[model samples]
Target: MTSAILVSILMTLVAASTPILLAALGELVVEKSGVLNLGVEGMMLCGAVAGFAVAFSTGSTGLGLVAAAIAGIATAMVFAVLTLSLTANQVATGLALTIFGVGASSLIGAGFVGKTITRLGPVFPESLSGHPWLRAVFGHDIVVYLSLALVFGVGFFLRRTRAGLILRAVGENDASAHAIGYPVIAIRYGAIAFGGALAGLGGAYFSLALTPMWADRLTAGRGWIALALVVFAAWKPGRLLLGAYLFGAVMTLELQAKAAGVTWLAPELLATAPYLATIAVLTMMSLGRKTGRLDAPACLGKPFSAS
Candidate 1:
């Protein structure tokens, strides 16, 4: 019984962490290419609604994921055009994107309210996923495994590949990357799109895997947590995983407390726990800046143009 309880908690931690890790990995790539997209929250919302809508209508999780990715990409393009092509402020545009996403997703998800669908389940057979001891490893949906794979894949892509070199160079100094004959704007565009798709997938994870239903602001500011996670990870994929799970555990505490009917802790304080963790991370980043431990992309949050 004790082991079973432990496994259940582990599963909850993995589920909560997966979305944040996925979103942060994409943002890591985007920041690596010198773009700071604050629109992760908005893009995620757009993806959540889009994924839920498509999946609900078609009853295919795969198609719903595709639609979510497409929605993320489309929404990301708006930021790309404004910041990359027209040279708008990346920060302001990102905030606008989040606001737009919140409003748009609320509008779009209105019909989906109170709707529930079959949660995305593990790909493997019940023999594994339902096993008493193996469930922790095999019980989760595919998104959980994919998110883990992405951690290594992203770390490798950024650290080992020549293309990764160029992307980093673009982030470090786009003017130099451009002078060396790299397409700065194009690389950033691709990075932004990739970020969007992942953010969308993460968003869908909430609807399809986590809660399996729709509600207004279903994501509940996880996108912002994802944004801080990139910084907490110090732009490294491994650290991002740790940060994500840490935050996830913080979030899980609230659920667990409520489930156990713990009366000592206020629900409001529990709700604030995750956000407080976010603030602590952001504060760490700020403090690290003083100690010179902060090493973000030099050109991050800066607008880039070929001209």
Candidate 2:
């Protein structure tokens, strides 16, 4: 491929990777706080529709993102109330959340189908964003930069900060954390809220930044892939970046294949490339986990209460 073509592909890959990385980073925090929310896909859907509707109506991508985050937090509260307060089964509750998100989004977005809006433009001006070499550094929208920044932020928060240390304490042993007056349940609620908000933002990225349109199920199964990516990275932020880019490359390859109309592979198979890679990565991680090498949070998925 020519340099220009390569640059274009790289740009697409970055765009594709950002949402997954954003969603996975949020989930990493959720898991680290000892909660497993499977409703990420649903939350993303809520965010997608909410963001699109607001942005499309108000002519402000920024407002749409805000609406998406609220929608996500609202949806996540359902899971938090059930799993945290009522102590529902985490697995079952999570599955239900995903189902609810799918149906609710469809209902909410029924009228939004086929609608289009202006795509989010680059953050930098033409002088930088349009330059041959500098374009790679400045050619993307704000969300792209935000996603990269969050990676470093999360790594720092989880490893360097004292609050991060406390959150870890709760995840490692909720009872112990509570005994120390850390308010275990409260910290978890905050984590879940943060996760939901990020998932929402990630979902909004699909409609506002990537496609700049409204469509039901627009996020497809990327939320699930994000969930899988957390496992693939063993819950490390740095590795999460690597894994998101890897999947991004897979998605880019699929897009290139479809664009070229390559007859060597079936079109349907190309579409499944990202999911297939997710499954393969998950399988490898599972096998390695058989030796107890996995670094999962100790209290993950376990219901906790102050009582």
Candidate 3:
């Protein structure tokens, strides 16, 4: 019984972390290219509302996912124009974009509050599902699998690809890369859009698959956690997966404790465990900077002027 319970807890952790992992993966790539996008929260919210609205209207989860990605990309384009083209301050523009997204999503999703949809379940083969251990480990909705694949894909791309090398070079020293003929602004724009799309997909997953319902602020700061995860992982994709699952497990455990009537912990504290843990991790990382160098792109969050 204890083993079964533990397995269930682990399963819940993976399920809860999928969305964060997806958003973080995209942000990792964008940051790798020296672009700082703080609008992930807004993008995710937009995705959630757009996805819910579309799924409810068309009665197709697939279309809803597509719509969410498109919305995210559109929102990101606004940021791209501001920061990349107009050379606006990246941090300020990103925060403004989030503000816009939050307001826009709230207004757009006003009618969708409290509405629910029939969610599409996991799509693993029956053979995989039949195995108890494999089912616990591998059986999940399509988005979960995609998130895992993206971790590996991003890791490989950053480590092995020439294009990725160029991206890194641009991030590390934009002026040097520009002198050598790399299109820094163009690359950053594309990476920002990609990040937005991924954030949107994560939001869509929350609405169309995870909760299958509409709620204002449904993402609920998951975007901020994802941003922290990127920093915690030191911009490494492999470590991002570990950090995401750890946070996810903490969140699931809090809910389980509440469900199991654990009398030792206050309900509010349990509910706040995830955020508290995030704060603790960030504090530790900040204090431990001397032990290892945290490698951020040299040009990250800086405006570049093309001569």
Reference-based lDDT, residue 70, model 3: 91
Residue 59's C-alpha lDDT in candidate 2?
93
After TM-score superposition, what is the CA distance of residue 90 in candidate 3 from its true location, in Å? 1.4
The segments of candidate 3 whose C-alpha lies over 4 angstroms from its true place after superposition are: 125-133, 291-293
**lDDT (10s digit) by residue, model 3, range 113-164:** 8888889576788777545567786567778888899899989999999999
**Backbone clash numbers for all candidates listed:** 0, 0, 0
Those runs of model 1 whose alpha carbons end farther than 4 Å from true positions after fitting are 285-290
Quote the positional error of residue 286 for candidate 2 in Å: 3.1
TM-score of 3: 0.95
- If scored against the real structure, what TM-score would every candidate get? 0.97, 0.97, 0.95
Kindly give the stretch of ten consecutive residues in candidate 3 with the minimal lDDT sum.
129-138
lDDT of 1 at 246: 94
Which residue window of length 10 is worst by lDDT in model 2? 285-294
RMSD of 1: 1.2
